[model samples]
Target: MLIKWSKDLEIGVPFVDADHKVLINLLNQVDDCITEQEETTVLGSVLEALVSYTEYHFTREEKLMELAGYPSIDEHKNVHQKLFHKVRAIYHSFAADRESVQVDDVRSFLQSWLTSHILVEDVKYRSTCIDKSEAAKQAGMVPFINTNGTHVPFNEWGFLRVLLVDDNPNFGKLVSTILKAVGISNIEVTQTPSEGLALMSRRPADVVLCDWVMDEMSGTQFAAKMGEMEIPSKIVMLTGYSIDTLQTKVSSPNISAYLEKPINAHNLLDTITRTAFNG
Candidate 1:
């Protein structure tokens, strides 16, 4: 583990604390990639996820600081900017030449930066009174929700095994990249409905994200096959069509949710968590 989370490291702000915990988990995942000497693509995905979430979290924090009327918001953002740029530099360097990047150096830098920032810098905001926007003041900004309208815990994301089926290899790659970028480690991409079905027969995925429109067969047909086979997988339909207009055509109960493409990390994760986990 890169860092062990404790109360002492928290800022006592609900949303911030929650975000920190998720960040810690991602950091540990990054450490795992480094230690295992994982493939460049896997490391890149993890780093992309870490970098993406870090940027978003920083934006959220800065907004909260503004809402709280914190005097040092500018200074805090400067600190954030510097750190963000540094991380980005590391990511880009890896992307440019994976072999040239020193894994140990990356590990040590992230480990220190995350722990010290949380314990020393973030601690300053714990007691800062942000009496307005109770929703934003709490963990409401967590940006993850299931069909039941309950927030999905960010830590549970790593446990998910996602299988994606889309005819387009490029689109499949894009979706798998988004999945990995959201900290989902176990993902398999299949190009055809038959391949997806065959693979699921051998090993059922926790969730199957299938494109709505396939060349050989439609997503509904795929879902129907899975339903008939009693494959215990949540089917999240990915389509370019309007959700309201498209949802009407879906008859299979296996399809738990429908997402309009093009997809991003937040919407994709939200849909998966909402459907697959039943929470």
Candidate 2:
């Protein structure tokens, strides 16, 4: 299923939030078309519309940032350019030969980029650029909570180093992108646990995010090996299976936290915080 628009996604900027809703709707349309296996012409039309509107929104946003005297306008524009180029490239490739490219992959890339941008980068300008719309007020009033119903403090998780080991390359790429958007720059992504261990041996990461089931090594075994090697990295296991087994497996001291599969920004960051600060 595709992600939905929520209050936490709001950046307290009315115009930006409004543009995001339209983008979210279009994004959902794209996802639905891909999932439903719609016709090529219909998908192409929607893709073009999404790309065009995204350019327009970025331009308008840059102008507003300039007017508001945003400190990071230039840096923000650079990020916008990166997204624009990537989307345009995908559009051209997709249009040239519809069969040459996978539409589902395109949907994944789009979903990752749009949602992460709104939640990570755009929110940085909220204090300087916002209107007192009812939407803004509602966004402000809504409190962000974790799974345990505790308040989430969006603090600085950016300082820590992260090593993400997962067999699925696509999932690894998506998680890496989300981590960067959240200001966690020092990240090393490896497809196998052995490769991850080699990297960690060179320089230990603050947190190690590993998948549960892999061909070479399981997450529990990986944690045990790290403990023996004295890597000093907190293990955050990622699993899609039942936690009943995982609860007993991740009992090692190095295993800091275990997160379920279908990782999102909130849970990923929350787990990292818990391990990073010894929570």
Candidate 3:
């Protein structure tokens, strides 16, 4: 099935929309490969590409959400972590038991997951983020080009710095890259939650993007530690899981935003831009 991009999905963030276009194209390629009855070798190559791209895309999104100070980031990051593990486990099983691997299995999984994620969870955040961004702009926190082509400098837009925290080294790098791409220069990353917390104590960032689950400390635990330490940065939890499960557990004074996994760069950027400018 062709997943057509529409205006409703535009969250006023440019880079993220571009990434989503790539993601949909890749998913379509997998579908096409399945339809062509491609050999296992070809199918495996496609699957590998899918895995690699998905990992990168998800990391980009989580980092953006973290930068935006999304309140539900932890839940979203959890979902991404779980899905990554699930996909990786399946890939490993296929490699170990080649005879049991089927093209249909891979196609079905990717199609279902991608479709649901984009249409449902992702769309939900667009309006909220847009409103927040516009509000920030109006409040003179973020500068925007007026209709006459004049630029307005907002004091709040450039004052904030951020840190991206995740256990995956690749993810941390990817996040840093995306941040720089979006005009955020003062960005730091750490693979350890402890280091992220330590950074917070020494020099509190304006915002933080943290993964939901990590080997040493979960994002929730890290956020709790920040609160205990009286760290003042706005915490945006990153997760790949359902926010419903974490809503009750996460209270105010720590988390300012929550963003789901596979976060769009546009929404993430807008969120961060707004949060920085608004704050």
lDDT tens digits by residue: candidate 3, 221-273: 89889989999888777766666765666655668777655454444556665
Please provide, for model 1 over 1-279, each residue's C-alpha lDDT reduced to its tens digit, 9 standing for 90 to 100.
679998788676667776787778777766766655433444665676667778878887887887777777788888999999999899888778878988889988999998898777776765673344663555345443343564556567788888999876545655555565446778999879998999999989889999888998999899999988889888888877788867888857777888876444566677787776663
TM-score of each: 0.59, 0.52, 0.46
Model 2 ranges off by over 4 Å: 1-155
Q: Model 3, stretches more than 4 Å misplaced?
A: 1-158
| TM-score winner between candidates 1 and 3 | 1
Query: Model 2: per-residue lDDT, tens digit, 51-165?
Result: 7657757876777777677889899999999999998888678678767877668878987998899879998888877753543444333322245634334345556799999
Q: In model 3, which range of ten residues has the least summed lDDT?
A: 140-149
| Candidate order, TM-score descending | 1, 2, 3
Q: Model 2: which ten-residue window has the lowest total lDDT?
A: 137-146
Give the candidate number with the greatest lDDT.
1
CA RMSD of each candidate after superposition = 9.1, 12.5, 15.7
Winner on lDDT (1 vs 2)? 1
Predicted candidate 1, C-alpha RMSD: 9.1
**Cα misplacement distance, residue 227 of candidate 3 (Å):** 1.2
